[model samples]
Target: MKEYSVTPNKNAEGWYVKIEDVAPTDLYSKKDDAIAEAEKLASNDTPSRLMILDENHEIVEEKKY
Candidate 1:
């Protein structure tokens, strides 16, 4: 199972999903959306960006999103 963190930023412009040292991905939506997106993107990776889990942050559930 993978882990992910959801952070709300007042100056960040939108919500974000941080997966540790990795570059944070701006979800530009609510926290739930960010988590859902992260979970969906976790299994898929791309050169432009990567979808991963945050070992430090606790995602709502251990399984699924």
Candidate 2:
């Protein structure tokens, strides 16, 4: 049950879902899509945390699974 984060990618454009320290993957064209995917992944491991970040790289919301 690793913690996950959905953050915006400034360089490539789009959002990314990161699992722990490993390089973030699961790029999405929209922030909502990325958040949804992150939540789904977190759901598999109950009680995991999913952090959603804004374009400025600041955390805007946190979803608990």
Strongest candidate by lDDT: 2
TM-score of each: 0.43, 0.85
Over 1-65, each residue of candidate 1 has an lDDT whose tens digit, in order, gives 34444555655445677664356667555556776776666545322232323334434344333
Worst 10 residues of 1 by lDDT: 46-55
Question: Clashes per prediction?
Answer: 1, 1
Worst 10 residues of 2 by lDDT: 6-15
Local distance difference test scores for all models = 0.52, 0.84
Candidate 1 structure lDDT:
0.52
Segments in model 2 whose C-alpha atoms lie over 4 Å from true places: none
Q: Write the per-residue lDDT of candidate 2 for residues 1-65, one digit (tens) a residue.
A: 57999988877489899998369877899888988889888999887988887877778998788
Best by TM-score: 2
